[model samples]
Target: MKYSYEFYRDHLEMLRIKLPGEIELFADFIEDISIEQKADEYITKVENVLNGLYQDFEIQLNATSVLIKKDMTVLEHFYTYEEPYENEMETEEFKELMLIWKSKIPERFKKKEN
Candidate 1:
């Protein structure tokens, strides 16, 4: 399940960091579940922006991938992503949100349109 651009923006806000360019529009690949297979193609383009802002950011990750079952059960699959630090990241609100997001995994993040 892909999030709306606003959702992405909300998360990006928590990073308190600037990206040099536009992220690929969510509309561009909203239907591309197969994107997981070709994610390597986007690494360099995305990494160029992220790496400049964050040393621990996982540019190699296509962290958007989700596993959805017939029962509507969902699981987020991510790797090598760094946890946001309270001191270095955003506010207490952001930290609380992140912790909730991590604890709940796909449950907390399941797209409303799903």
Candidate 2:
């Protein structure tokens, strides 16, 4: 998929406009929705949800780094970024944050819980 830096910037903008708890709600929606065997509005909503997760990561990375352009498929941004500095605290904190964004999968799509 093609991910643009501007798209990521927009996603982060939504996070700043929203409270953190509401941000988590969006994250939960992404984690809960399945891409397989779905169509129409649900797929669109889930894709939007993933876009939000990508935006959160961009915001966190940009907050700590110069945000120079770099190439990485796993990221989104307005500019490419090199990896930011890391200490245990930051790593642990990022992991915690990502848990809300990326920490769910099922045995299969059919097993998805409501």
lDDT of 1 at 19: 20
Clashing pairs in model 1? none
Q: What TM-score quantifies how close candidate 1 is to the native fold?
A: 0.20
TM agreement with the true structure for every prediction: 0.20, 0.20
Overall lDDT per candidate, in order of appearance: 0.28, 0.27
RMSD of 2: 15.2
Worst 10 residues of 2 by lDDT: 1-10
Error of 2 at 88 (Å): 20
Candidate 2 segments exceeding 4 Å error: 1-22, 25-94, 100-103, 112-114
Q: Go through the candidates in order and give the clash count of each.
A: 0, 5
